[model samples]
Target chain A: MYHDNYEEDDLAAEVELVTSAQYPQDADVDDGFDSEGVVSSQKQPIAVEIPDTIKNFITYFHRNVLENNIYELHTLYEVTFNKLTDRFYAKQPWPEAELISPLVDDDQVFLTLYRELYYRHIYARLSPSIQDRFHSYENYCDLFNYILNSDFPVNLELPNQWLWDIIDEFIYQFQSFCNCRNRIKNRSEEEIALLRDNPQIWSCYSVLNVLYSLIQKSRINEQLLVNKNGGDMLEAAGEYGSRPLYKMLGYFSIIGLLRVHCLLGDYTLALKMMDNIELNKKALFSRVIPCHVTTYYYVGFSYLMMRRYADAIRAFSTVLTFIQRTKQYHTRSYQFDQIAKKCDQMYALLAMCIALCPTRLDENIHNHLREKYGDQLAKMQKGEDSISVYEDLFQYACPKFISPNGPNFDDPASLSQVNEPYQHHAKIFLSDIHNQTMIPTLRSFLKLYTTMSIDKLAAFLEMDADELRTQLLMFKQRSRQQKWITGNLLEGDIVSTSDLDFCIKQDMIHIAESKVGRRYGDWFLRNITRFQDVIATLEHKN
Target chain B: MAQLAMNRPEVIQSLIDGVDRYNPDNISILEEYLATQCQNEEYDLMANLAALKLYQFNPHLTNDRVIINILAKALTAVPAPDFNLCLYLLTEPMIIDESIKQLTALHQLLEQSRYAKFWETYKSDSAYEQLVSEVRGFSRAIRSIVARVVSMTHQQIASSLLESYLDLSGDDFAAFVKEQNWELKGAIVQIPVNKDNEAKTVVIRENIKFEQLTKVIGYSNEM
Candidate 1:
């Protein structure tokens, strides 16, 4: 827990103290900043007076690495590295706090040291195996949180960077370590304890959480831009500082808000939240340059919730332009492709909603919907009698709108902006639509079968087709001699005196002769014929 | 085991329909009277009709296992019950087919073992043992019939069972077919023969094995 004693005024005082301590003669302090605003000790760069050997080593290390606080590692570098660098890193003769003043945030410096000390204690308690990965930012944060919350034994304060080192080690080796026999195959008590005690164990999943947050934020920012007033507000605010801040914060809030609304069955709130982005769109553009394209698609979705056909179509069409552009590149921004597909799906659903409307006004709307959603619109018109209401709905709802095997928006450029998992949700959404009267049973089955492979079908039925086929054959052979044919079953009973007659009468012969579904249907007919032959032979013998 | 006429499918169906007309206690006597009265009448008609009616409610209820279990419970209190009477009462189309094959197999086993009247007593232990010994291959055959029935449509199964039944009797089996009027069966296509030429016709006998039958069917008989 962080201490509450350091107020804003106290921070201002500390900053003034640091600035005054650093610049004694130049009292030309700006009116905007308080006297204690700057920390002076940290302002001093590492001195150049150190020996060439020491300076060279420090220079090589700096060149090889991204800039990070060095005081944490300075002591070790000084003691071991003096032979190489000739300059001492952290002499330890000076107070450690004073030595680290340059790197540490004044208010948080003591707290940071306390947390580091706690993590070291936790790390010391862990087994040697766990200790190996106890290096990195993530590991430090996890270990710090654990030690601070619990009573782990150890006496010294650990540097925050050292704590982070543990976490960094854990992350870099996480996947390979998990794959090892000691981690997965032979899950010893030590490994279990490591998992239970180590907070960094969950950090791997935290990356996905971060990604989701960024995506949500991106989406919200775009939505907020649509509204003229909200857009203006963001633009005006962004002029003074970072433009992406307000938009990112606004969008980050949408995922949780939308999720809660969805769970509460508050369709109105969900619709409004989705619609709000567009309502405040102008403000978003002035603030954030990289807004999520899915905002336009979801706005159309909100229109769908309201059952507003024309408006939904207009909103969705805007998203289509982005969809076309995003596909031109070989790889897309991770969420950009998702946004495009979502637009297409929303368009499809809008078509369905229009088709479902029971009004003469929807005639033009229905035609538009049918153009996209209907399988064979002209045929339905030609044979009006064949068109059932449910079939029309099936055509309109369009179960096959979302293609699972379609191209993905997976480019490093887009993904680099945010970190979120792109676990496609379209299939689940489509399945739900299928279940909720979007398509009739047979059509849905056909669509599902077309979308998924035969292998997947086996999983759905909970039986491998190859195994089932074998069982069926064995069953047929066993019943071959039985004279009694059940009235409940068709194949066992002879339909006609002649084999040709039976085949023709049952339409089996016609099916066999046809090239349609030649492989699957033909295979079925062959099996049926084999069984019939066995039945006929047994009857003759009897 | 004795068969309970009250539990007979026809009587039970009637009981279900005439819930207000017949007292639950009088069901046993009423069923017995009806069964006794209908003994001389055609069983196939009454049993098939009752089964077809019950089947409309839930097709799987007419399954062999389901029907057999019902019949077995009905016959629990009776001694030396007739299998034919039990079959008629239960009226499960699949069970009728299954029982016929089982009975024929039992007869074949008895005839082979030189004891033709083995199932005459029909006590629980004796009947179970007799059935077990006589038809060692019963379960497999029964299971296949059940599976075949499950696979086929109702009409296909009905026609197949009817055709198989005719074949079992073996005397101008087509007569039994003609008697049924082929209501349960689908359309049958007959190839027309020219009357101008005298052709030597070969009747494909029931004794032909599968391979031989296949070979025979394969040959185009010229007229």
Candidate 2:
């Protein structure tokens, strides 16, 4: 929807012919971007100026906001605003909310929405300064306070996509703040003091409080339950939940909690957040492609960490296939690049899970995985020398883990130990891999014979029989995991995860492998469709 | 509701499954609940991890003894990734402490199913005893895990090896086998056939459900 016919090369140009046609206040004023004589007191490399077109756009945006014209806002949010961003502020921050407040008549709601995009742009393109972080946090508090605690049924409406983005970006910034807070190095004394003093800014407790409060205020859990099993919708929605604004926010907040808990390494709690919302083509999260990809990304990641490899494989495969099937529909989304990036990361994770668990995958996903991670997957399955391969895939694909607490500013010595959380997670996961390092070798040996004495197999592997026995036991235990059938993500039955199974009696080991049966359904369906096509063609010819 | 904390205590279920998990004041409640789990030999990884999670955000509330107890209980749920899940929540310095290192050594031995070595190191130093002082019957808890893994992997184990793994002997081993409904034949202990130990050939066919076929059925109406 963005026309990239702009001739302006400056990151903060005032306007271009492209956006000016709609607003017509195009004052192509570029006064060399002087850093001095800036309006706000916050020192910036580029000065903040309300370009005439954006100023005009904001006034029109204010009218649309007043009318609650979500249809207009969707085009404005998904296309016009982004096209303007690419034209004017591609490499620079948007005009500050305060700087443009006058153009919108100081309308708090519009200014709040503008600031959301303003700070989101800073986070996306430029590095957000500490003040930017704090002020953006305050702006969020203002926005949420207006919607939540306002005595009236707030006369505001938002498209579902924007609502999801609000929650998504809110958690993103919170996670960003957490990771930033963990790094206390290379910061000025003033920045450190600001961070140390205002401990509530982007605090974990406060962030979770906002998400949970959204869920509770909207009574979203009850609403979801009523939707699932028939019930009184009005009673379930209560007052706030009846409003789309509150309902969507609350629903997305559940997803926000999933991402947050996964970031905190609470994998079980991550999945626990999605108890009511089933992962399907029709879930509200699927309406936003990024949200859909994100939900599966975290769910798959949590399952991988929780040692449920089969479930992880299923989660990753389902979403990867969905993305492939629906590619044409969302390739133009504003977050398409972000979605594609997550799509690639999920492929990497799927490769790792497939190598570890040996699950059959859809042909399309399998080909993509082989294309993306063939050599690494080969090295991973080679065993014992593939530690670095696993770690590289993990680092590339895993969520950015947070340490939850900020640096102990009281002790400067501890500040240098910032890599502790990442190292901690890597160590735990690598050790888990180390336990199964002997599986490939043992599996080959097991497949060679249905019944073999443990002592004889140990001789071939040049190890003690007792040690071989231990490896076999490890295989038996590791290859069985809890899989979701029809319930909350956490509740699942313990099913055999491996294609191979074995039993040990006295000194003898017996091995068996489960193979997938030949499928006639797909072949019949394909033939039936072809036959129908032939019949239709013949009848049309007559 | 996902608050299906199933078997967990109501107070703990509410606390751990809600925003209260972030509350520093509620940690003592989880801590006390952890102590009860230890006393009853009733391990709950979710609740224990919740306690560690609270300690993670609130450094002041961290109790090394409670952490050790939690890890010790996690040692009972070995091969489930519970111990490492708890370890993930602990800071680097806390994980590398002399006490945690000693426990980790036992944990490694146990994970490798080196039951004999685990029993040896677990009993090696007085510090090991002092380290697990908070856990009421840490030895019994770990023994049950060993007993479980052994039965799952073996239909019959040499009595000497089983005794070494369990760290029980003669009459104690016999009594243990009897309690488990297992029998002691001359040189081997015969465990009852269970699902995991049976290892029958299973053909995992595709489970195509009626709902998945509804679309195909719709095409039949067109026909």
Candidate 3:
């Protein structure tokens, strides 16, 4: 007989009983915590109990954070820290027994974040040097113990739910904190004595270990879409029916962290992480649709950054190939067509990233791009300017691709009627993504031109550099209108001419789609098609 | 030597029987084995060689000189079976459901297949004629009264399944009418509803307008 009447209250009590019993080494298997050296299975009950006072304090803290009221956050943190100290009284029954069970890393990490936040808030008045000296987890825990042994006035009963909620926030926040910390710590290191020294070799030893730790989770699959009984994903990571999106987010977050590590000259570690990403891509690509063009772009960019241009070319080419292979749904309206065109331009920009591969790359790399990409490569070679090839490709391809309305599966007159307005709208939208999104990307690429040894080529792109800058500046000035436009950032046009901005935007969009199963293909097709028409219109003006 | 001679016929028969005993599952396993075999460079080279020998008379089967030229040109990139498999799944007719879905799939496959050099032969005018003939074969089974009730396009004839047409026949014409009730034909592709009218008269034009054909058949609306 399957039990259908499982209550949250009962589960809370179950968690408490388990926690008091001194967790078996494998109790972590339930939390599905593997990467942080914690393993727990669903069979093991986690008895996590927080007294009532602590629960109210955390609830207030969350409410305040959501409402952006800092004063409440300050009050909650102050009260919780005081309660935390009192909970560790000298005569406490569990004080003699290690307060932390070895298997409970998830809980420990959660508590660590909580303590970190508390310490950061309380020590804000201290000097920066003083803050740094006492920032270690051991030191922070010691502070808590010191406060507990002392006469700390505390009246609090932590709620059963408080610990879980705090744990969730901690998991989310710590990733970002670790990423920033890695970058800052690495920047202080001195440059190597020799150029001939293999940075990759050095990086591998230093960075790879951390990168592996990040994406060590399982592959994301489609089961993630199911929302069975509101059991959270991290708690149910090993479950067969876990939603692919959450797992995917976890993977991406790790990748993003690894990317930061790479930027900090931890390339060896980043490369290791990328390998895991590549190996798991089949699962990722199959479940994911449309915008993996960005994934390819990043992998390629990472290679390009490390002077592994040949590999970079392969990645960029793959992005372009996948884009080209995709078929747009048939729609009569030009409006729908614009969306398709926008998609094409995005892909084209991705292609352009490889097309403009820095001349500093070895002879083998130059030949590889030329041989692999062919026409796109030829276009890159025809002009020394990075942005010019992009400009030409966008202007040439846009008219052919963009559309406004979703495709009408049937009807001649109806499809046409539906198309006209959408086409017009799409053109405007695409033109905006171009003026706003692509131009800034070109500007950033223009700056990279100086880094290349090829002066003549760099200068060529520089001639039109100001025009590109002006165009982006105009776009940047426009206010954000759509809900998707965070801080007025245009999605696709965010990358530079030499950089794969469209790919980035595409990946970002793919991420959005994967997270929420709302299909944007119809709108995408319309928008891209309209973009093409706008390009055609511009060509006529020119 | 004398003992081998006596058992040779039995040995050959045993080998034949062994192959004959292969079931569908056995064939599947063999197919996988063969695929992996053909993937080997030596096996591929031998295959080319075998075809080359056969091509001595039938150049159409395998022209060595042309094969060499093609191989030389294709040396840079190997054909990706995964990519081809994706294409197959995307265009395969085995997945067709409703009449509308079948028709859409048919048009899509035909149009895209026309662009590929590999698939260009399938898009010839004769291919269209064959499809038309197949449709005519299906239409022959319909009675005069029902034939009068329906108008068919050449593209439709090639695409519409015999079973689907049969489903519309006899007393089941009511179901057919219900299915068509959702189908919108000229000017717009949308359903039109009229209350309290069971046997609503539908005009079946013998000749579909050019624009309607283009909208539905020729160039993709999205393209």
Measured by lDDT, the strongest candidate is: 2
Q: What is the per-residue lDDT of model 2 for residues A6-82, given as tens digits with 9 covering 90 to 100?
A: 23323224332232223323222222222221332223333444565665666666767789998888887888898
The alpha-carbon lDDT assigned to residue A506 of candidate 1 equals 27
TM-score on alpha carbons, each prediction: 0.24, 0.91, 0.23
Error of 2 at A11 (Å): 26
What tens-digit string does per-residue lDDT give for candidate 1 at B200-219?
A: 13333324236544534453
Q: Choose 1 or 3, whichever is better by lDDT.
A: 1
lDDT measured at residue A245 in model 2 versus the true structure, 0 to 100: 90
User: What's candidate 2's DockQ score?
Assistant: 0.63
Candidate 1 docks at the CAPRI level of: incorrect
Rank the candidate models, highest TM-score first: 2, 1, 3
Clashes of each: 51, 0, 78
Query: Candidate 3, which segments miss by more than 4 Å at Cα?
Result: A1-57, A61-111, A115-130, A133-261, A264-272, A276-298, A306-542, B1-223
lDDT of 3 by residue, A1-542 (tens): 11123233342333232354664433211111112212111222335444433333433344344454534444454444444444632122111112322212224433454455443322222211111222433433442233223343112222212322222222223332222222221221221111112222212222322222323332232123223234455554553113332344445534444444333322333443443343234535323232243345445544433334345445555554444445452232222343354445444544554443432333443454455445764545444343445455545432221111122223334323322322332332232223233333443443443222223323554545324322322322221111111211111121111221111110010000001234354455556667767976898999
- DockQ ranking, high to low: 2, 1, 3
Give lDDT: candidate 2, residue A462: 94
Candidate 1 chain A minimal-lDDT segment of 10 residues = A496-505
Binned by DockQ into CAPRI classes (incorrect, acceptable, medium, high), candidate 2 is medium
Chain B TM-scores, listed for every candidate in order, come to: 0.23, 0.89, 0.16
